[model samples]
Target: MLRVCFTAEDLLRVRFADEPAPMVELMLAVATLQRSEAVFGLWRRRMGRALTRSAGPLLELVPATGKGPLFLDPPIPGFDAGLEHVLSTPTALVRSELHRVHARDRAPSPWTRLLADRDRDSWQNLEHALRTAHTHIVAAPWERIRAGFDAERAWRTHLLAGQGIHAMLTGLAPTARWRETTLEFDSTDDVEVSLDGTGITVLPSVYWTGRPLVGRYAQGWFLVYPAVTPLPDIDDPTSTDTLAMLLGRTRATILEQLLRPRTGSDLVRDLGLAKSSVSEHTKALRAARLITAQRDGKAIWHSCTPLGLELLACLPESRGKPA
Candidate 1:
């Protein structure tokens, strides 16, 4: 089992990886597929319309570095020296035009900071944290509660107990400080933690969900500490074969699920199986290149690869009349 701490670095890596390819393509396509002036004109028009209609802030999100036009700090110092020359010249017209050029030429926008905020609030991350916590409970099998704990209550207890442990282990206060804490569960008996801490708790559950525990000191939300383990290295062929052998019925179920995109937890709940089993089967299918798995927070979703579909098409029906 992989012991993982939900850290900013880990979250950033996941964000970078999971950002849709289409968004990148759209940006590139706008520049290359259309005339440069036409592209700029369109952008300017859009900005003008938006500014005209909105009293709210106008914000543009820029990448820190790489393939797109240099918006943020350049890889090399003094790379943007020429920017002043262009913006200062008469060619730079409308204020929006200058803003666009500055955005394109200046250091990356502070939008990343805003993004960080949203990432902290994302539900997807919360789900991931919960799954991770459950896995930990299963692996270690915490003293089973005397009464049958519903998913929600179990999660709440786990979060509270885990928070206590997290404080002991990390020596850090909960990221989401709380004057009061409470827990909630989903329809499936899944758990959720709400906190009222001044800041969000960097606990496992929060890490998985990427949501900050939000609330005031006197009326704070619950804090959940999830048990997280390292994700096993699934790339090893031996690991793949072993997982595949163990999968049996799970293999068929996963294959069917991957005919379309499905999240890890979705598979586990739908199949009425343990998360470890789902994860193991997913690892095998992913290794075989029969399916592709992409991480969206704690949940890693899977889908059938073209190769997998082709292979499936070729399989002979066992009871077919034809040989």
Candidate 2:
């Protein structure tokens, strides 16, 4: 278990990410591809076609398990930054982080030795790998990815406002729980981190939805975890049915709930629908092209397509009236 100890002042200074970090997403995307976790099997399969030679070098950075190198200093470096900032990361910092990882992991490899030698080629190769991965994996679906980031931010904001910081931290993941002054995580490593009044930056990632990544970063300290919502995917087989066939209060309510991106679990809690029922309804809505689903980690995030929003806009004010 991982424990994050906080001072009284730290409690007042907690912050949420304003947006997703492109480099962070790229790293997690590479890790996910390497493992081919069942949750992201579909994404991996789709992205396989886009993989390039650059991806090979970066895969060495992420081990099959354990904390990978903190290449992006300040774990959550870019708040609302772009891809250019990531590519522009100083070579010196990249070399330093790789050395740290090599020292800790003690996993000897030609790539590690090259990076340790401060080989400019190795640094350039890492950057190129990130760039290539971003273009192929994240750039195309960025709109949906950003939406998931926004949704997670909003949800945390709500938790902060309604129940306070403790709620926000513990609610971050099912495994995260608070007990008195220490926040504990169901982690693979037995570690303890003290905030020491530095406060923590809580960043969200669409690609990493499993465990909370806790570390001391340049931006004070941080916890980078999967966003509450998943990146949006629009891959269900389209059907020839018209929206009118499924128009009703229930379907309309589902569309309304999707004004912002949400997940099957979110809908289950809000609408009090059975898991199977929610899944079936979403499938129908997706087939009608009124909603699109993006699978992130294990959760499938749902958002209304333009057509779905347009249909909602045309609906009458009556609660149960069909559009």
Candidate 3:
């Protein structure tokens, strides 16, 4: 298991990422594209077309199983900034990190060894691989990705407010546990990292769904894990017309209950709906930008957005009281 040792001061300094780390996310997205899940099916096609001209470099770094070179996932904002970070890394460091990746993975070609040497032509090709992948997988869909990040941040903030830092840390992942100062997540690697008051940057990711990446980073220590969004792939079926009927009332009631941030468990109990049904309704509302969800442990806390509040105000049935 991965263990994070936190000092009292370190606990006080737990930080949330204000923005998406594009490079880190790009690496993770490439990993997801390697799988054949329906959600990633479209991207897989695009990736094949986009990277056909030059493929092995990025793939070699981002293996199907374990993580890629740590240098690739720099905690920098914007894609260009991440590229800049990689560009600025000492050539020796790049070679060393890639060598470690080669030890664990089997994606390297004879040409990729130039990357270990930081050869000029090899560096350009690697950058080309990154650009192609980003264009195909991350560009057009960035808004959805950004929204997910915002929702996760809001969720983590809510948890911090109600339960404080310790609860927030241990509650980050379902299996994560806090024992005194060390936070543990189930893993086979048995890695331990100490945070000697440098604190951590808790980064939520849209594509990474594996063990939490607990590592010593430029930001002292870092934790990047999959966002706990409610069925991120499920879209709401209640169309605008359908929402005008009984379905509208259900959504209206959901909006009302959400005025004060509420957990999924609260909604299941209050709305008297099956978990699957509630997920359907909330997923729809979220897609409409009428409501937003933040993770509070495994249960996500849903709350109405400004647009939802305006809509709720106009609905005569919902105007009077909180549901």
Candidate 4:
């Protein structure tokens, strides 16, 4: 089990005192899970077969909100009525819009057939059915393993990891706002602590499992931070350095191809490299802050860092002049 420790000071920074620390943490966890599901669903629809490898890991890590009855008493602040209403209501509006857009088109994808059907109720039912059927058997085992290890310690580690992933995707700093109290884990491992914008000493622990699982679970939390700012312009010179660092590619051709967002598989196909190699290179790039990966269902989409574009523009053409 992963347990999170937050300092009093950290809690103050984020103004989280209004709600109890535990409650706030749970809410954040739920939100992050929700976002992951949404992103994953999108990817499953878009990429289809190519998503097999990453989809298993992602689905194993994050499961959907279950089929419990919608809460009517004091409802969840923004999402009071429930997910059905939340998804169904907007879907009706979107279906109409799509119909208009495709009115002149001769053909559309098989999946788009539903959009053309124009039955909001049927579509909504289908959506809910798909969500319900979507299962990640691995997630249950992993969660069981994590919980059995060190409940509170595991929770905190997963939380931080999720926040870190969120930071990369949205380009927002992953921060933990917590109270300053030092909570020791049951284990004897030295509780190494770190601080972020929040006034909390994030206690790192290794009580339950090894580092690999910790790293994998932590990613769920890392991708949870909100995207607070617009993505930086890719063409700016200063951004190129950042991109090169993130993607680990100095070649002009590779850099140029990454300008438009593409899936890891697409990149592998185009570059004639093995998928594993592409994944490794991308991970390194992500670690260096040179590129960002956005999860879409089962596949990860990659794009150049803003700094990468600047580097591309500065490179001299074959004719010996900058393009």
RMSD of each: 22.0, 9.7, 8.6, 19.5
lDDT of 4 by residue, 1-323 (tens): 12234344544432111111121122222223343333234433443343344332222222232111111011121222233343444445445544543443223444445544655664554444333322221121223322222322322333345554223222212222223343222222233343333442121111111110101111111111211111111123223232222222322334566789989888778888777767755654453344678999999888888644543544333112112
The predicted structure with the larger TM-score, 1 or 3, is: 3
Which scores higher on lDDT, 1 or 3? Answer: 3
Measured on C-alpha atoms, candidate 2 has an lDDT of 0.67
TM-score of every candidate: 0.23, 0.68, 0.71, 0.24
Q: Give per-residue lDDT, candidate 1, residue 65.
A: 19
Which clashing pairs does model 3 show? Answer: none
lDDT of 3 by residue, 185-294 (tens): 98867788988888899997776666688756565678988765322341232322212321244665787788899988898898788887688778757754668899
Against the reference, the lDDT scores of all candidates come to 0.33, 0.67, 0.71, 0.34
User: lDDT by residue for model 1 over 44-149, one digit each (tens)?
Assistant: 3543343322311112322211123222111111212322322222321323333544465464344433323434443243233223322332222222211111
lDDT of 1 at 313: 46
lDDT of 2 by residue, 199-271 (tens): 9889877676567888775556878876533442311112111222223335556788998999999998989
Ranking, TM-score, top scorer first: 3, 2, 4, 1
Worst 10 residues of 3 by lDDT: 234-243
Better of 3 and 4 by lDDT: 3
Residue 144 lDDT in candidate 4: 30
TM-score of 1: 0.23
